[model samples]
Target: MTGTPNTKIAFKNVRRVFGDGPSAFVALDHLNLDIFDGEFVTVVGPSGCGKSTALNIVAGLLGVSAGECRVDGDIVTGPGPDRGVIFQQYALFPWLTVRENVEFGLKLQGKEKSERRKIADHYIALVGLTDFANALPKMLSGGMKQRCAIARAYAVNPKVLLMDEPFGALDALTRVRMQDQLLETWSKERRTVMFITHDVDEAVYLANRVIVMAARPGRLQEIIDVNLPYPRNDELRLSPQFAEIRNKVWHAVYTRSGQQQPALEE
Candidate 1:
């Protein structure tokens, strides 16, 4: 499939399957999607809907069984520095301090020690982790660990961020704060982001558009545009507009195929 010039990530009739023959399971079926440059897109659906599967394809952690997954017009063959991935697990190195963790990718790229330090410091500060730069992962709270993971991803200067339930493990209050912090960072950095979440509120709160997927052999069930202005906060979350959009995403996610209702409108 042809993608527009502005498309940063494109999935053309993508399909992914596991196993073979009679017991084969299809995770994604003929999926087609486009994430534009500098746009924030959140994906939500029930378990086994391929939300993470799609993100994994973009991260080059998994291969598509059919069709293509492209990044910046190039076919995705493997992981590259241009794409950064964050999962629900912090995946931080227990032996490394926050600064070292953030600098890991830069070190792999053969950056000078001073240059890596500067970049890591900037991103660590960006994620509000300046105070813990020297602390190991064990010293951080769940939210703080996630923030460090995010900072580490950013320090690499990726063009796109593929996040799979990055805030899922945090407490309610912490999750809310992380959402705001992430939006603030996105506003300043403006990278293309495709975040996956099971929470409808979180999906609507953080995305330019929310992608809802069907169960099993996942395909796009609906795409809801979030027209609300950004710099989103707790005050915005309490607004009726936010609830409206949240409900739309909720219905799209929970409503089953045969019982699907008419789509909601603004």
Candidate 2:
């Protein structure tokens, strides 16, 4: 696949296999995709569809069996500060306060205490955690904890954000709120984001393009473009345009041939 100047994350005929021998399983098969700079892309598919595997490859946590993955024209060999990752579970340091947690990456980079405080304060306020900056992780609710995690990721100023089901663990109401909050932050930061989720509404609501994968040697099944405008809200979610795009993604994920349907919530 040819990459353009705007391509922030490029997967060039990528493949990933687990184990060695006849019993080996292929997680990804000849996947080719390019996520442009400042684009919000969401990936959705049934279970075991290499959704997380692909995110891990971009994050440099896993190696591809064939082909290559690149960030900003450089091949990814391992994890780097240029890419920030957020998972379903809030991976905050329990012993640390929100400000300290957000400053952890900067501290690791040998940033002085004063500079770390300045950067941490900015992201903490951006995520609406300014009041809770001194509170420990145990003092925050699930949604608040996730917000703190996001603040921490942004504090490092990564060019790309790889999120794997980051809102999966939250309750329904909180999940919706978190989605809006994330979009607001993204609009201001404009970082390239590759978010993986199982929810169809979320996949359509938060993405410029929704990537649907097919299981059993996971590969791309379809790419549905969400033509809706930005600054999305609850009213937009109820519109016909939103419903049409959501249905397209739903059909692409569930109606594939010879695939067992998994229990996925809309």
Question: Which 10-residue window of candidate 1 scores lowest in summed lDDT?
Answer: 257-266
RMSD of each: 3.0, 1.3
Q: CA lDDT, every prediction?
A: 0.91, 0.93
Clashing pairs in 2: none
Quote each prediction's TM-score: 0.95, 0.97
Instruction: Summarize candidate 1's per-residue lDDT along 54-145 as a digit string, tens digits.
Output: 99999999999999999999999999999999999999999999999999999999999999999999999998999999999999999999
Which is the leading candidate under TM-score? 2
Looking at candidate 1, what is the lDDT of residue 198?
Answer: 80
